[model samples]
Target: MKIFYFTGTGNSLYVAKRIGAEVYSIPQMIKEGRYEFEDEAIGFVFPCYGFGMAKMISNYIKKSKFKSNYFFAIMTYGGKSASGLHNMEEIAAKSGIHFNYTNEIMMVDNFLPAFEMESEIKNKSSDEIEKKIVQIEKDISARKNQLIRKGVASDVLSKYVHKIADNVSKNFAYKQIKVNDSCNGCRVCEQVCPANNISVTKTPEFSHHCEACLSCIHHCPQNAMHLKSEKSKARFINPNIQLKEIINANCQVK
Candidate 1:
């Protein structure tokens, strides 16, 4: 079994690791120009953005080929997953692929503008999350045939929710991130950026290819990187993951 994942702040990577598969970073694969894949069983683990899969994930699914006897997906979300899994299905189907199993696990929502990181961290209990992940692992091992499909009501609501958070998906990189004087030129932002969109010289500079995954803002030790509309000053990285793991997962510099 093999799993491909995209992560910011480590949530999806944690889940992918817990599933006991040969895990590969989606960003790293893209950076290395590795696209075509085949396996006895394959899966994708990623965070939901704008009530759908991240644009990077969606684009990869649309263009690449994943040949497998069984396919699965696990979505990690802080708030509502809504129809994110279904949205992913549509993208894969367009490429003549389908998943054998799909599931979602709720984790801290890292959308800094709407969800306060402190509150999101405090409110979610990881114990319950662990239980869900264990069950998902068992299901995948058994090759479960469930596919997550909500009806029209969910599709309608998902579109509305997605529209509200669409800017998070936009490519206005230079205009999005804000860095302050507290920065010490550490370059953690450049290392953590999945899009290869940051370069540091005394302060980090945004390239036009921002994925807006917030890895830079959340992982900055100096707490200097930020969004202009962030809710609170608090930052978040998944408790089960370490800083080096994320850098290894998304770092474009190799």
Candidate 2:
């Protein structure tokens, strides 16, 4: 079994770790040009973006090849999962793979535009997360199948909303990210960016290809990275994940 995961602030990584599979970082896979894997069971683990798969994960699904008897996806969301599971089902179908199991886990929402990190963390306790993970682990171990059922209204809404929102987000979401005066040109942001979208000189330079994962923002030691006028908002990184782990997952090839 191999679990492919994409994470921003480590929420998805935490869930992926709990799944107890040989985990592979999707960002590192893309960076190293690794797109083919053969395993008995294959899994995609990632956080939902705008009620759908993250753009990088979707792109990986399109470009990668896999040989597996069972394929599953686990999505983490901070609120209502909306139609992300359904969306993953469609992506799998398009990839000529049948999605065997799909599920969602509630976690802290780090989408800074809409969710306040401090408040979202208060919504779920450690016991709650462990309970959810236990259920997911049992189901995955049993190879249980879950059919995506969002009804007609939800299916239609998710399709259009995800398409439009993903497009808009990709175009403008990372545009406002800038290194403030507190930056000492540490180059941490450039090194941690999963997309290879940041370069450090006097400060950080951002490219237009950013995935908006915010790894740089949260991992910056100086707290120098911020969106437009966002210096006041608190930052979040999953407590179960360490800074070195994130750096290795996002920055190292192996």
TM-score of each: 0.94, 0.93
Question: How would you encode candidate 1's per-residue C-alpha lDDT over 1-254 as one tens digit per residue?
Answer: 98999999999999999999899998888888888999999999989988887777877777788889999989999887889887778788997788899999999988787899989998999898999999999999898899888888998888777666665456545886788899999989899988888899889888766766889899999998777788999999998899999999888975
lDDT, model 1: 0.87
**Which pairs clash inside model 2?**
none
Model 2 residue 32 lDDT? Answer: 82
The CA lDDT at 15 in model 1 is: 95
Put down candidate 2 lDDT per residue, 76-185, tens digits, no spaces: 98877888888887887887878898888888877676777778877778788889899989998999998657788888888888888677665443577766799999
Error of 1 at 111 (Å): 1.0
- Note each model's CA RMSD in angstroms: 1.7, 2.0
Please give the clash total of every predicted structure, in order.
Answer: 0, 0
Error of 1 at 149 (Å): 1.7
Deviation in angstroms for 119 in model 1?
A: 1.2
